[model samples]
Target: MTAIKTEVAGRTAAPPPRAPRRRAQGLQGSRKRAGWVMLAPALVHAAVFLLLPMVMLVALSFTDYQFLGAYHWVGIDNFVQLMSDDRWRTALLNTVLYTVVTVPIAMAVALLIALGLNSGIRARGAMRVLYYMPQVTATVAVATVWLWIYQPDVGLANSVLGLFGLPPQGWLTNPNLSLPSLMLVGVWQGLGAKMVVYLAALQSVSRDQLEAAQLDGANRWQTFWNVTWPALGPAHFFVFVTSTIASFQVFDLVFVMTKGGPGSSSTVMTYEIYENAFQGLQLGYAAAQSVVLVVLIGVFTLIGLRLQKVSSDV
Candidate 1:
């Protein structure tokens, strides 16, 4: 028996066979090749479309190259000029103000609409379609209709106001109200899409968790605050970051509705960037402003992430 045991032990497990190890090496190499193949198109796309343009924009921002310039380097003079201009200052303020006011209001309205649609309402399907319609509607067409609605006199808005014995006050014509009115239209357009997102997120919520809370004597508000809200972190973050970025880069609405007017009161960053680049033909300054817009959005998004942490923890 001792001899047999020694023989079995000395069989050496055949050194665990190098072929298996070689096979694993081959598999790993294949997986690496697969990953590179999968990434090749995306790499090409980023280089051609995104990275190249960004490099050009950065280069442009450092130069004195206007529309008809003999292309010379200026080294941040465009940026300095931007800081000195009160119009750009107003544009920055309006952009920030629009972002701060609209993102929260739009998100709140979207969340409420989601809650309503998710409560097993009778017309849930139709209601969802209704809410989501604005998301698919053409922005120009929507702006056209809103232009009518905001027409100050003989418009839907003023007509409704007159029913309450109020004067037909200027909506888009008043600088004080133009930005806010745009914010309102933006909210209406944004809420529809955000509502769909929230509804999808709300669907993934566990019925068991909700029922457990119910059994634990939690009211609807308590259950939502304790369960639903926490479960909505991903959707909340997505909606917020996208909406905040959109707010910063609001252009089409401003371009269509008021052309950044009520006397430049609605001149947001993107609109300002467009005006500088195309209208004023200050391409380098516009590039500088675009870079600033990018930086500003990045900083604000970072702040948003921090706030989301605090809110989620609570």
Candidate 2:
């Protein structure tokens, strides 16, 4: 009887208060609510602007919408037509070429400039500002400046060529040189931005590892290749992806400089899309082209990520 009474008393002791646990749970719930509240604005903005527009674009790609009148669904006809469009093919090829040429060269030049800036060089701040000026400057302004530089007669480029006894070449007018001339401007414009990214990456490299490499009798190239380059992997991936996207979407320069001419030589995908959408009044076709551009960017990003993974694993 005594044991039973003791056991019943223990059971009826109100079982150690759960108020603390309840309070903790309540705090967590409140925190979650606060987090949601804080995130609401960004979520709403993305929903209304980004997600909605993307959905509209995809929907519009399937219809013959020309910004007026009743539009009928055309299914995949737009995409089918894209497959056979010569201008589309030319634009795609040009875009790919531009991206392929500019990205690596721009990255290399930027990395070199970053290295120079990161070193114990004098006036680095001033140099950095000078290099980064192009990035902050308006694209239209940059394009306009480059237009003057590329003039066939009495241009800076031709004048420099003349100094070396070289004939004055038509930088913008010639079909062969127009694309390359635009590429030179592209590289120059992109350098400052990529350099800034690399500078940040380089600054974060491990000093201890670098010293250890030096102590191990590793030469400059060896230390840099093994230590510095590996440390820059993330930056490399970032620069490559962003540069590729920018290169693929090049337009303002093409517009202000060549206008996709000397027989569509310097025509890019974005320029072609704009021409179709506004000039030709083929919104659906432009939407299809936009879809392709998105897909291409996605593919390139995936490839860069894969390469980064492989390099990291190695």
Candidate 3:
């Protein structure tokens, strides 16, 4: 029996090793070639479109270049000048203020709308469409409609205020109110997509856990705080990051509605960049500001991620 076992073991171990090993190596090589082939287009696209443009922008930022003029290297002069530019400083401050104001209010409103819609209300589908319409609408069209609505003399907003015996507001014309007015437009346009996201997140929550909470006599608020909120952690993080970034990059509404008007009170970073690059013909300065914008966005996103981690750990 020992001899039989030894023979069986030897038979199992004695297969020709070189051919199978070579076959595996060949298969691995083929897979690598296939992967490279599949990835080549994307890599080429990044190099040509993204990487090349970034390199060009960085190079341009160091030069005293305009859109149509002789270019010469200035060695951080553009960045140095940016430090003292009052217009740029105001633009930066306005951008930060806009982001701080818009993201929280928009997210809160969206979350509430999602909760209401998710509660199995009648005509929920139509309501969803209605909420989502603003998001899908063209920005230009929305801005045009909002411009009409904000007309202090004959607009719907003033009419509504009149109905309640309240005074009309100088929404876009007032320097102090222009930024907030743009922020409201942004919130309105952004609410629908975020509400849809929250609705989707709410749907994925485990019904069994909710049922168990109810069996344990948990109230709606308690169940939400303990079960629903935790489950929506990922959604919250996503909405926060994207909403913050969008707020920081806000330009369309300002450009369309205000044109950075009312004594430059509504000017934001993106609009500032556009003004420097095209309107003011300071491409190098715009490039430097653009780099700063990129850095700010990256740093803020990292901080948000850290906060999310800390909250999750707690």
Report model 1's TM-score to 2 decimal places: 0.95
lDDT of 3 at 140: 92
Clashing pairs in 1: none
Q: Candidate 1 lDDT, tens digit per residue, 143-219?
A: 99999999976789999999999889789999889989999999999888799889999999999999999999999
Q: What is the TM-score (0 to 1) of candidate 3?
A: 0.93
Runs off by more than 4 Å, candidate 2: 1-14
Predictions in order: lDDT: 0.91, 0.95, 0.93
39-95: candidate 2 lDDT, tens digit per residue: 999999999999999999999999988867578999999999999999899999999
Question: Residue 261, candidate 2: how far off, in angstroms?
Answer: 0.7
In candidate 2, list every pair of residues with a backbone clash.
none
Tell me the lDDT of model 2 at 80. 99
Q: Write the per-residue lDDT of candidate 3 for residues 190-309, one digit (tens) a residue.
A: 999899999999999999999999999999999999999898888988998998898889888988999998989999999999988999899988999998898888887897899788
Residue 167 of model 3, lDDT score:
96
